[model samples]
Target chain A: MNNTATYHKAIKAATSKLTDIRKFVAKHAREHGFNEKQISDIQLAVDEACTNIIKHAYQFDQTKNFRIELEFDGDQLSITLTDHGSGFDPNRYQRPDLKKQIEKKKRGGMGIFLIKNLMDDVSYSSNNNTNVLRMSKIRS
Target chain B: MKTFKIEHRNSDGFEIIDLYGELDAHTASQLEESLKNLISDQKSNIIVNFRELDYIASAGLGVFMAYIEDVRTIGGDIKLSNMNDKVYNVFDLLGFPTLYDIFDDEKQAIKKFLSDS
Candidate 1:
């Protein structure tokens, strides 16, 4: 994976940056051995993560921006989505247990759960005013 | 990415389209265009089958939202049936259960619409 991207403060956390990054991944993921199902799953995972950023990252001001990056080496893909607005404890984020929620028809927190299920690896870390979320999947 | 294949059948004042595959950002535009063309031809009372559909996204839901008002205003309706969990979750998230009539099968959806008419 190679690194690339520029960050700018633009319209809160809602920007086309995330979608562009996802499309970038989708395009490159195809070059690897990712099938349609795998691509769609990865797309959805990226979408959910972006949605979360827009919803929870910053204050409701339209003068902020977030950073998103995507990289792929022929065998695997990695995405690093970061927000400078705020940072939260990843350990405190409890994903909804599907087995328990299925019987109750519950909603909410499905984003992280789906992302975790689809991606082979997920990690979160905060450094110098940036909350970075990294997700990846290997072609198998 | 998802592709939609449609099968149309003419009934009394109704036209049913059996849709297959995912309805997401990559494919929602196709479905939207197809629906627009059919509507322009005055074919209404549409029922979309999701038996083979695996998923949908916000963009796909937006397409239905765009057409719902037009179809209903013209005294026609659009119904959905046989949605799997992944696809259904998208609809449920957008509050589709209150906006449109959804059923477990095509027959039930057709009958429900016909009876109302």
Candidate 2:
């Protein structure tokens, strides 16, 4: 079997498309020999990232497009999501205070936090009109 | 692919919702609507069983957060039970255990609610 493979898909920035995005990542991860647990981790990280883009960046506008690119080389898998919507600096984002969230019972703001913790590497950058978020995980 | 599903049942005077498949941003609304119906009927003593929940994103987590306050205010509670480790980790990561009553089994969750009354 080839140890390296790449796949890409573009979908509208709608919440309904999150499942397809997750399946896309999971399929490539499974083909790369990632175990069930690892595949779920990768799927979840990608799902959360796309959710953030749809809800915060594109505001659930179905007309906007976000592209997901998955590349698997050997035991490592990297996913890059490119969105044409306005971008935010992920570095400037703060992890929500867990105690406060529980106290106030806030319903959101954990998407980026989960993505960072689930993936081995997560980074964000924007060039011109496109925002890119790249996340990677290694099979263990 | 199998989409998310919620099976509703009643056991020992509590509403049990069995969640199956993946629960992400798209399917969270389905859970939300079900919860709304339950709350509307004044059946807020709820236990969500995650024994078959394959995946859960933050949006799914948000659904619980969105309703807990209302449920509790109406003299009822939303309890979670039977989560696989993967699903539990997501809830634990977000400090949900502190905010919600989570149990290892549906019976225990129902017992807690029953004992509270």
Candidate 3:
């Protein structure tokens, strides 16, 4: 039995497009038998990942393009975001100290943290001026 | 595509903001602008009603974090109310309960602000 569905789209690297991307992911997650909570978590993770690309990689330059691919296989869902902007190693990323952030009243740095916690697995790779971030979640 | 909208009202010397639709990185700026306007007007005590909010992301949560200190410095606070399970779950997952006062009802939040002042 093959229970796999894949979706791919190329969008401008702009914040305005984040909502649409999240909607696309949520719609497919729902169709793949994900519950409300699971869908919301996936939606948030995708939004954060795209936001990082827009803000950090493309610097909100709408001229750049970011490609998003979503794959659903059985009870597992995977999201891959690719951009032709600045890329870094995900392993070197450090989780912010929640207590310190709250005490210092920090405003940002929670995007990647939330992505790591919400998704079951997260990996990043960049080659030849292109960056790819992949995240997966398995429904229990 | 759902857009985010915020409705502002003044009640009992507190600014009550009603959030509607999805709140993500793109729409969080609107909330930030509203908070800035409120602070400039010296209306810091705020009660954000989230009953109608369908979705929220880290950027949406960041807006609250950005202004909380400024509001608190002036003897005011931002209290949240009427968050559904989904919205509340995001806040809770990020450990927001320790940083902000979350209430079950808007009236309760308003009352707390009034009593504290």
Q: Which candidate is the best by lDDT?
A: 3
Shift in Å, residue B44, candidate 1: 20
Clash pairs (backbone) in predicted model 3? none
- Deviation (Å) of A98 in candidate 1: 8.2
TM-score of chain A of each: 0.73, 0.93, 0.91
lDDT of each residue in B7-93, candidate 3, tens digit only: 999886678999999998899999999999998988889999998999898889988887888898888999999999989988998
Tens digits of per-residue lDDT for model 3, A57-137: 999999999899998898898899999899867676566665676558786677888899999999999999999999999
Report the C-alpha displacement of residue A94, candidate 2, in angstroms.
2.6
Model 1 DockQ reads: 0.08
Candidate 2 chain A least-lDDT 10 residues: A98-107
RMSD for all candidates, in order, please. Answer: 8.5, 1.8, 1.8
Q: Rank the candidates by lDDT, best first.
A: 3, 2, 1
- What's the i-RMS of each model? 9.7, 2.0, 1.7
Give a tens-digit lDDT track for model 2, residues A69-136. Answer: 99889888889999988888788767777656655867677888888888999999998978999999
- Each prediction's DockQ? 0.08, 0.64, 0.66
User: Which CAPRI category fits model 1?
Assistant: incorrect
Candidate 3 residue runs with Cα over 4 Å from true position: A102-105
Looking at candidate 2, what is the lDDT of residue B8? 99
lDDT for A53 (candidate 1): 69
Candidate 3 chain A, which ten residues in sequence have the lowest lDDT sum?
A93-102
